[model samples]
Target chain A: MTEPTAVIHDIGYRHYDGVRLGRGRATLALGVQSLRGVFGFGRTTRAKIMPLLLMAIMLMPTVVSIGVMALAKQFIMPYPGYAVFMQAVIAVFLAAQSPYLVAPDLRFRVLPLYLSRPLTVTDYVVAKLAALAVALFGLLAVPITIQFVGELLVDLPGPPHTADYLGALGGAVLYAVLLSSVGIALASFTPRRGLGVAVVIAFYMFTAAVSTLFYAVLSSTGRDDVAPWALILNPFFLVDTVQSALFGTAPINDEGYPPGIAACLILLAVIALAVTGVLLRYRKAAS
Target chain B: MTASATPCFATEGLTKRFPRVTALDDLTVAAGTGVTGLVGANGAGKSTLIKILLGLLPPTSGRASVLGLDTATQGLEIRRAVGYMPEHDCLPPDISATEFVVHMAQMSGLPRTAARERAADTLRHVGLDEERYRPMGGYSTGMRQRVKLAQALVHDPRLVFLDEPTNGLDPQGRDDMLALIRRVGTEFGIDVLVTSHLLGELERVCDHVIVIDGGRLLRSSAIREFTRAEQTIAVEVEEGQRRLAERLAALGETVAAQGRLLTVQVSADDPGRTHDAVRDAVCDLGLSLLRLEQRRGRIEDVFKEPVA
Candidate 1:
């Protein structure tokens, strides 16, 4: 047979098995591809440089917080506690940067390049979320750990005993995961990266502001009892509630640890639903 | 051309619908070996069909297959064997061609070492030169298109779908691209499904041609069938053109003068006789023969027919 004929025969035999790579293998390959894509490997240098720049920017708050504590410790007291400061920084970073990470691949039709490979819609979504979460953790972890060590060195009273470190780590991880999911969910609604960024920032900042405004109104009106319930309106507050509990803050008069846990559970459920919606939207957009 | 034992690509009643448009509607065509041109105007469903075959787009109705694998269920399998050069410019501007093509090869399941080797070979094949190491953002349109083609072939796919590969090229660039495409299909032994709006361009290279209009199949046949041998021969003479025409008609040939040339009809099976008769008649008439050649129908002629 001629070379072309031989190729045809080879293709035919290859097709007999139908799919050469099993589903599990294909999924794993796709996941790796997505990680490579998100990290900008084998793509444009901007893809490589942009993520680096974004991470650096995300870590900016850590540097700023550390500087403020070291240089002007007398004025910046309570230090807002490292957990609160780190949480705020992460919220801002996700609001500003997460959208850019996920939106462009779909908006610019770059998703076809990924989808054309063995990658599935779910794999792409998971990879993106994982990438953002990892970046967020890197940004938050270094500064928080530094601040924790610094506070110890200065012999300052910390928020919790050493016994609570594990719980605090768990709380931070939970918050990071939820934040990543929420950022992706919001980004999925629009293809425009700038718009996605703006929307996410607004979603995070606006809900937090509204929840605060509601609490202030309730407190001024002598209804401090109802402030904890009002906190449920904000996902960030749910995160804060968990942090506050980990730090052994005063429990709400009406409800105890179970309510805060329930609220966190509810927030997680929302994150799951939002993630599902995003994935479905991505799949539809791909098709 | 006789029917091959198996078709390179075949589709049946493929349909796809979007909210704003019916992108592909009951389209069906079968293509054999060599370069097959899928010609259609913009928004004519050419891209849609290519995407469906690649399993990028799910058909709302009907069925399709590539290399005998079902597109609906085994798109990944088909993609592994069928390369695709998309029409859009979506390259990451910062990465080098080496990195991009290697990643694509790896994506198609090649090992790291093999992917790198294939990437280098394919990039050289596309004539990227030393600029392959530079970022793609600074490259010219022609270079970008070549890079896209290189990545598509980096996996050594058996068949490839090149959508509007020459869309942004100048005439010379377009010619070069067409030549390269011909080499890929013929010299490299890869079956090519290339789409173009330029009918004349495909006429020179494609072994088969499939015309589509309004998301529907109009015609699909070998290029030879589209440009079949005509019974008429066009004759041009330096002098005695009128006398030559008169002599040809006197010899039982039906002839007509088209400007300085004469068109003579002959029996379909007697093409050699028609040529001899024309030469004899011109010589006897003492006329200087300028040109004598059979005229075949162009692919553009088929475009003039009503869509079926």
Candidate 2:
């Protein structure tokens, strides 16, 4: 028998001498990847089911309103009112998906992998916040844009007003920032995705119910001044107050705009608080 | 600094104390670029030292650096140049290995195309075949380990701190992983600091071994220095062990007798002479020779005293 010859293959490990792109590009990739993850772009069919369904549901009213505008020769749904109309669906999206984005890293202990990279704790938090904000912006802006375009396509009582459309676009930005801060802040605390979903849903429902209930009790009791302040309890109402004050959209709870720029201040404060919650949660997780 | 000039990592009186207990107590050691094994029993602070060196955790008292970057102030730069494969199961269950590794490569600053190509190359290098496309939820422990390893290498790090990489592998998987670790240091040009509780396993792949216990450095030396063979021969007889020991000891040979085994010292001047004497004495005593071989010192011997 012949002795076997020992041969080594030029395989296994290969060194990469390409462009690294450094921390800026790494943070950008994390943000883009996270934004794609929010709507289940790179995920499975089972994962794609929830986000896409919620989107279709969100667009349902826009389709119906466009059909109404075509047949009745009048635009029924205003661009700014589309999100408030589909607020429940938007809330469900946030509750279901914020956990999908944040919980896996904590549950599986993958933060070490990310923190071990060129990314810092603050970098991770900011990227996730930015992703959620951008995603939420898309959720609101798309339907609002379709409504504007649909109004232009149909015969309306008046031509689609560009000023109001721009106002609603401004409202979408406020809603995006506020909702994302709240969504990530709530989801970061619950590591178990199942529990995170429940926590978010419960948090939104509790705050929303409390705000509406307090508004009803206070305004009906002639305590009108204190009633609009209660609306700040709900996240949608909080942003909607800012939207209503700035863009002159129909206020959902308050009779009129809350004082002057007090609504905007309240929103900025609440956003700051929720963002702090997110930062603290991540700091603890990283440590 | 050039990669070859500075050590892979170094510590200066590094100490990390938790609220209740200290994890790394004044560990001061440095290793060159090679497969250096960080070995200790469980809870011996091997993982803690790696974390401090990776700049993920700040040492309570002292300082550390990897590739000349400080662990505290220059953590981001250090992490950019270093890769870490955590000991635990860190893979997200939903994504395929290819997608996960690609994202990780990008997170480590690799460009998109480079990330993809390196992900494939690294996955194949780690022996993940078509299974790289499969979701990691269904992977066995061995495959998951390979995926973890692939992610660490996907960005082509200059050095990698592999924390208990062979934690849950079978015997064959362990051997394959050790061989891959050796190749990672030499063939890939990436220095490695692999940790294990099993001392015997690292003896095969490590160019140097560092032994720590109770958060303190015990010994650090080249592998050859640790495993240098003693001047002794191990003799085993089928029967008449007492007669053989008596004959050898009477012939002025140092013999330590056990049940059926004997260790006879070989003189430095006449090594073959001692072997002949043992063989002839056993034959005269009519004891059948079962085995005769030189005694080689083991890495495990360092722990024998403390363990007993």
Candidate with top DockQ is 2
* Model 2 chain B worst lDDT run, 10 consecutive residues: B299-308
Per-residue alpha-carbon lDDT of model 2 for A82-190, expressed as tens digits? 7777888999999998888799999989999999999988888889989988988888888778877888888577657677778888988998888888888988897
True contacts kept of each: 0.26, 0.95
* Pairs that clash in candidate 1: A44-B94, A44-B95, A45-B94, A45-B95
DockQ of each: 0.20, 0.72
Say which candidate scores most in TM-score.
2
Docking class of 2: medium
Question: Which residue window of length 10 is worst by lDDT in model 2 chain A?
Answer: A251-260
In candidate 1, position A108 carries an lDDT of 50
